[model samples]
Target: MKTLHFALPFVLIAVGCDMSPDYKQPELPVPSEWNTADDAERDSSHISAIGWKEFFTSPELQAVIDAALDNNRDLRIAVLNVEAARALYRIEKADQLLQIDAAANSSHQHLTEAEGAGPDGRTANHYQANLASTAFELDLFGRVHNESEAALETFFATEAARDAAQVTLIAETVNAYLQWLVDRETLDLLQRSLASREKSLELVTARQEIGLSSKLDLASAQAAVESVKVSRAIYSRFVEEDRNALALLIGKHDESLLPAEASLENTTILEDLPIALPSNVLLKRPDVREAEHQLKSANANIGAARAAFFPRITLTGSVGFASNDLGDLFTTEAAGAWSFIPQISIPIFDNGRNAANLDYSEVRKNIAVARYEKAIQNGFREVNNSLAARRLIREQLDAQRRLASAREEAYTLAHARYEAGLDSLLESLIAQDDMLAAQQAEIDALRQELSNTVTLYKVLGGGVLR
Candidate 1:
């Protein structure tokens, strides 16, 4: 027993040797600055520093986003995944520690006279109680330690994934809400246009009845009214569909949760993101962080694989007392038995299985590296795209608003001329059609601008803080 105790310290000292490789983060695969960032002003504050509640100023939108964070099914699944990964990590970490189990057992045997027993049959009973540790690895080559590290990294990756899911959910919910508002506004515009076109049709019919207008004029007026009706129908359906989509995201069907009336023009969102920020901000993004964590896990897996090439040492031990009489089980006079088993399994022959595992782990690490780089590149592209949209969409929206205004003026003039018998009703109808098209275009541009704002917030990792 004393010899075994003395040798255990030397065996434990061997655990200090680690075969895992050191890990270093890969270099960034993208440019240092954004292409569209030339005209952007520099700001010290990063977009990620701002929480979602601060970024989305609308109270209604804030409420809706909060509900989504709480009730979204995908987010729930993401949270659960994090928990499961944490549990797996715990299981791996436990492998590195000592685990002692208490066990008790009793045995009975009978020997007949015809067998190896004496003339008379004999019965025997045995009882035992012990504390034992079974097949505990010594981690001499860091296989178990590296495996624990890999599991820990995987847990962190899942946490980052949960954050990514949350960021995406917030962005989608906000965009859906904005789309619904835009659809409602468009529907209202179509309804008003239809009313005006219907009144014009009534006037054109009365004029034709009195022989003051031709059939062509009446037919043109009727066609204009029908066109507006068709647009109204389409937009009305769009509004309802948008509502359903928003409801699905919110995870509730209550009509009261949605606003009865809202306007895209009235909606407010934070638009000034720090466009001149450094590319390192991409690292703060949840998706990018998730990819990095996955890469770290793969790197750690390589360490475990490398460790597998070395010998593994396992120890099994037990200390117990055995006695024929049940009452003598704990007595000092009873026989005290103990066992120590130290097993060493050297990698002498495996048909290249360990080599294959090392190669596979290296390949997985390479794949993870590529994925991490791709994530950074994707984030860079999304930010640049949003920045370009932010600059160009504002200019385009300005032009659209101006065009709609001009069209409105042109329609008014054409209608006035027709009423004064200075122009044909065909000119008036054409101007009205152009005016409606321009108005719709302007509304669409506004919606795009708002949606882009929300998208910029998401791509920049704004909602993760919240």
Candidate 2:
């Protein structure tokens, strides 16, 4: 019993592996202050947890996003990347456990000189079967543990990347829809304006023939009508081409196009701007989260590299039944054969290779941390800029409305005077042009305002889609 007791220690050490490493979340700067506005309190409790449906709210826009998520090639590629990372993590997890293997062998030797030493000191036919490991590293120095952590972090990073892709997809879809709406409205206005100008040209021609105006006056009116028609043709082409672009972004492979529209219903043109707290908002951004997860993976690499300087202990072992005949391979009397080899290797020296690895890992981790911090700062910048834009655009829209109203009155007055013979052909034409410009500008300003609100939604980590 005493002898057995002494042998059990060796068996236990040989048969078991404990490779878990000490892990802790790395330290980095966190904001003690937040950017808050009266319009909102910083609600930081996983605002991103909401489904995209709740965030976007528009059935048309949501449909576009759903289609893109399903068909977008970039999103599919990110999913593939996550799969690859998961496979790597599985490999790392397997490293923490002992592995078993099996093998079989048979030999019949016709001695070259009729003389050879077998296991029993005689030339003979031999057969054997065994289950054994070729090599297994004992992770006593935490190398395997750190490697596993690195793999886990990489998996998490991929998850965050997927979320970031989702955010980008939603943003692009909304922007494309807004662009389509802007183009359509502009095109519609141009078409109507062209028709009105043509009627004016006809009137001027008739009046010149009746001696109510000179030929020069008629020519000027006709020229204005032609110029507007030319502009209409250009705008029509632009509208059609942009609609096609939106369809592509929504992952359309067929001729079918998206229900392109204005985001006006989807967002508010605020009489008062909505503002959010900026302090912890950056952390919720998928891009920032992705960057931080990458930093964690890099930090895990440092632990792995640091562990390389220590001794590596490995246990290579095999246990299997043996027999001289195939029929007896698993027979009760075919007693099992077994072996255990516990090995320890120290990197006494590596001509600076191991040390360099350690330095490189640490430096890389530092770089990753810096990158994560930079991403956070950039996120804050986007949020703040979006807020400022929303505020300024609201003011612009108001001013543009006033200008449009004034130009509208001027147009009516000019046309009246021309009909009453108080204004020249040139004056009426100029006033018509000014009115069109003001009206177009008003539409542009409203479009800009809606766009700013969407930007705010995105910069705020995008409603629940975060």
Candidate 3:
């Protein structure tokens, strides 16, 4: 007992020696600055610092996003995963400490005469009560310590994963909502176009009956009306499909949550993202952070694997009182008893099992490193692509609007000429077709431009503040 007391300090001192390698964050593998053509004089505040509600200013969209955050199944599962990882980390940390338990037992044994008992038979009873710690390992080589560290890193990784799920969910919900609005707007446009084409067909039929227009003109007007009907049908299906998709994202079918009327132009989404921000901001992205945590966990696992090559020391002990009679077990007259069992296990040979484990840990760490780098690379590419899309889509939308305006003017002039008998009816019909196509293209371009902005915000990790 005295020897144990004297060696306790030395054991504690030895525990300070950790075999784990010092951790250092890897260098960024991307460029320092964005390569976009946009003005570099944007807001310097990080996108992640901007809350989702602040960015998505539409009340209807905010409500839908709030519902999704509360009820999304994938996000719920991510939260549960974080909790499970936290519990497992606590269990691993507890293994580094002594676990004491109280126990009491009584036993009776009978000896027969054939077993050399005196007279007929003999009976003996024993009782004991104790507080014992079973197989408490002393972390002389930091194996248990590194295991705890690995578990802690794993917990962090799970938490980051949950955040990543949340960011993705918000982005998806916003995209879905925008798509629904776009489809509705397109459907409205198609319906109006169909009505106009039908009216034109009616006019052509009346003129043909009066011998003022040819059969070809009447047939052309009919074909145009049918084409508009086909487009309207397609957009009608699109609107319903968009609603179904949005319902699944928001986790409910509450029609009141959606806007009564909305347009891509009127949907309020902030565009204050700093396009000139350094690429290092990718580190703040939840998926990238999750990958880094995983890499850190793998690094900690290598430390545990290295420690497995050293000696392990365990202690099992109990302090108790024992007596032949149960009534006397807790009395002063009972025999006082204690035990100290210290064991040391040296790794003499293991047929290369430990070596194989060390190799496996190293390989896993390498894989984690690769994944971390890949995550950063993917983030860089996404940001660049979004930036490019934002600029190009804006230009495209401008060009489409101009084209629509020109086609509208051309259609008006062609109609006037046909009414005055200066041009054929077919020329006016062609101009009308061009005007409709241009208007549809303009609407599509506007939708694409707005959708691109939402995507840019998401890829820049802008939704995590909420």
TM-score for every candidate vs. truth? 0.93, 0.87, 0.93
Q: Tens-digit lDDT track for model 2 on 31-61?
A: 4443434345344454465565765666666
Please write out the lDDT profile of model 1 over residues 295-375, one tens digit for every residue: 989988888999888888899999999998899999985799899999999998999999999999999999999999999
Worst 10 residues of 2 by lDDT: 267-276
Backbone clash pairs in model 2 (N, Cα, C under 3 Å; residues 3+ apart or in different chains), count: 3
lDDT tens readout by residue for model 3, 203-312: 88998999998999888888888888888889889988998888888888878877767677778888767654555468888889899999999999999999999999
Native-to-model Cα distance after best TM-score fit, residue 109 in candidate 1, in Å:
2.1
Quantify how close model 1 is to the true structure by its C-alpha RMSD in Å.
2.6
- Which prediction has the highest lDDT against the true structure? 1
Write down the RMSD of all candidates, one decimal each.
2.6, 4.5, 2.4
Total residue pair clashes for candidate 3: 0
Candidate 3 segments exceeding 4 Å error: 1-12, 37-39, 42-44, 111-123
Q: In model 2, which residue pairs have backbone atoms overlapping below 3 Å?
A: 34-279, 35-278, 35-279
Considering only N, C-alpha and C atoms within 3 Å, which residue pairs clash in candidate 3? none
